[model samples]
Target chain A: MAARPADTPRGRVPRAEREQQMLDAAVLVFSRRGFHHANMDEIAELSGVSKPMVYAYLGTKEELFIACLRRESARLVAGLAAAADPTLPPDQQLWRGLKGFFEFVGAHRDGWSVLYRQARTQQPFSVEVAAMRESVVEVITDRLDAALRLEGRQVKPDDLTAMALTLVGASESLADWLADHPDEDPGRTATRLMNAVWLGADQLMRGVSWRPPA
Target chain B: MAARPADTPRGRVPRAEREQQMLDAAVLVFSRRGFHHANMDEIAELSGVSKPMVYAYLGTKEELFIACLRRESARLVAGLAAAADPTLPPDQQLWRGLKGFFEFVGAHRDGWSVLYRQARTQQPFSVEVAAMRESVVEVITDRLDAALRLEGRQVKPDDLTAMALTLVGASESLADWLADHPDEDPGRTATRLMNAVWLGADQLMRGVSWRPPA
Candidate 1:
């Protein structure tokens, strides 16, 4: 608690700010090296904090991993919700939402890939990923519901859930691919998905079906 | 190596047949109990084989698990490839393919859920899941390509890859949902995805876009 003579200036940094820096460093290292192979010393070095200090703040390796999962999940959920304006047209809203999601994944591809791959499949940690996914699905469902209501159209709750699930599933799949392909453009990926799903949604909602060409 | 007089009745069962029975038991036990909770004794009991025989045949627990994965993955991939006939129209082919997939997952829901959850995110085991996914993606891509060619329309390989990824991802997402919801019918699930995606694919391929309604 006491500031030594050598720790006066930067040591004055708030605990919260220092924690965020450590998380950022953790995300970077975890994404690059994976959880098992990653070391605390590297994370500390990256964060410019002492190893002892890192331990003091984050507790342990397992706890630090969970903390990273929580922060990353929160960031993804927040980014998605903020992307679409409620007042916008349905298609525009969907477009913005998809764009925001891919852009976020593209920017943090390594982190997203590592965190998602680890948490979604591993026990105890998967809960964090599930929570994030549920939040995302809810956001999309709300947007679609509001958009439908604007057109004086209402669908069954089951139908809405299925639609949201479809979009979410497809987006997650493509996002996984995007994460692996660094050369791929996030905006373009978003646009490609928008083109397919938006078109399909418009048709399906109106009771249209795709028949084989004659 | 010597067959006892007491074992004479069913001991005539061929080694391959007995191996198949053991594998069948392993799949059932693994699906129901999971790798960690499942014990070799239950599998041996189900197969009507002794614990030592099971161990001798399958080698070890980890090896048995991998064998189960290989068998399951082969079954799934074969099911998908066999579902769609080349003579059928593209839409029919796609419908059949999707139906086959959902049906396979439905029949083996517990197995798929546990195996996919465990393999896709974990070390070593994930390779099995990855191989299965690759096979599925390839099957879908070939179907799309052949169908497009029939109409004298061909897309860039990247576009095709993207399209295939979209379908694979969405189906997987919904499939995961189906595994959890035992009351849901896989056939109906397949139809739902077919309806949405087939419509989208047709329109998108022909240069049609969904514009926001005024």
Candidate 2:
């Protein structure tokens, strides 16, 4: 029988592959136990490596967590980027992006919690996650800007940024809601957001505004 | 000079007033240190009372945290309710509600953190905080539903709920953003959200939606 590559003893396992394995374990532990309660020993055991190896490769728990965050965040960003087609109109682009976001979150529930909830709570990782969130807001803002220009409606830069932030925040909150209610459809959730934000944004683009009654 | 009643020492201080002082200290300490790290001893010292007095008034650390959460959450709810006048049209009601929300959050930044950010992070308090969030969602949903009906538009209950959740979530994220960027005006932040959500909601009520171009 041929020897299985994955079954090879610890020292023989490639560094990159081993690192990936450790991270996979780390995500599960951190998601389940949170950053403070999660420990290295369990992560090592789950990764089929020893404690010493985890420390040697990943440095500290904080670094390991950051690595997990970066990995998961990159995956999400990559997923959204791949799904968003610049050639498409801004609404379609947004729809695709929202769909991709929900699908990624639904598929990677643990990753979603770790990146969105757990990382957000802990101080050390908040800045890292905030940067990732800012990039997302920037992407959405750019899309909105292009869309507005296409309609020949020029909005203030700050207004555009604020609108983008609200959209991102709304989507994130709905995504968390979706996570909690396992049976809910992500597509439907995405559609609901689209209906709520995009429709309003469309009206604003056309100069239709809702104001307080006199 | 007559000794101030509050300075008459712990045993003589009015129980209700003492409780409020302890909660004030708890909010500060909890917001600063988070739930797990916050201790009753510091809260007591900060409140100008003994640790036993804190225990007598607020109970265990978990109970005290919950007390702090309840007190802060109640203040916010009261502030919003007081600002929302039922006689006003729906948009204005929302505008006022949003204004009230931002003002409350802006004024009670520490309380906002304790209620929204800090309480949400820990396991024991998440459920408690979530219930508070649901009530807020419920209030918004009712407002949205009333507005839609008044416009003679009919929408699914679930869709209305989802929209309300999105609005609430968006406001929360922006409020956090407001917390970080202290220079930003809360009124403007409220206006920005109103422009994004209320306009979008208004369009949806009028049966206008943005769809991808063919």
Q: lDDT tens string, model 1, A134-202? A: 888888778778777777677677656767888899999899889999999997888778656765633
Model 1 chain B lDDT-worst window of ten: B205-214
Candidate-wise lDDT, in order? 0.79, 0.78
**Per-residue lDDT over A83-108 for candidate 2, one digit per residue giving the tens place of the 0 to 100 score:** 77877766677778888899888887
Model 1: share of real contacts kept: 0.52
Which residue runs does candidate 1 get wrong by more than 4 Å?
A1-11, A201-214, B1-11, B201-214
User: What tens-digit string does per-residue lDDT give for candidate 1 at B60-161?
Assistant: 877888888888888887888898888886667777888888888898888878777666655577777788888889888888788777766766787678
Q: Give the fraction of reference interface contacts each candidate recovers.
A: 0.52, 0.62
Give the worst 10-residue stretch by lDDT in candidate 2 chain A.
A205-214
Q: Model 2, which residues run further than 4 Å from truth?
A: A1-14, A28-51, A149-154, A201-214, B1-14, B25-51, B60-62, B113-115, B151-154, B201-214
Which pairs clash (backbone N, Cα, C closer than 3 Å) in model 2? A200-B200
Cα misplacement distance, residue A8 of candidate 2 (Å): 5.2
Best by DockQ, which number?
1
**Taking the tens digit of each residue's C-alpha lDDT, what string does model 2 give over B46-143?**
99988987898789999998988888777778877777777776667777888889888888776676567766665667788888988888887787
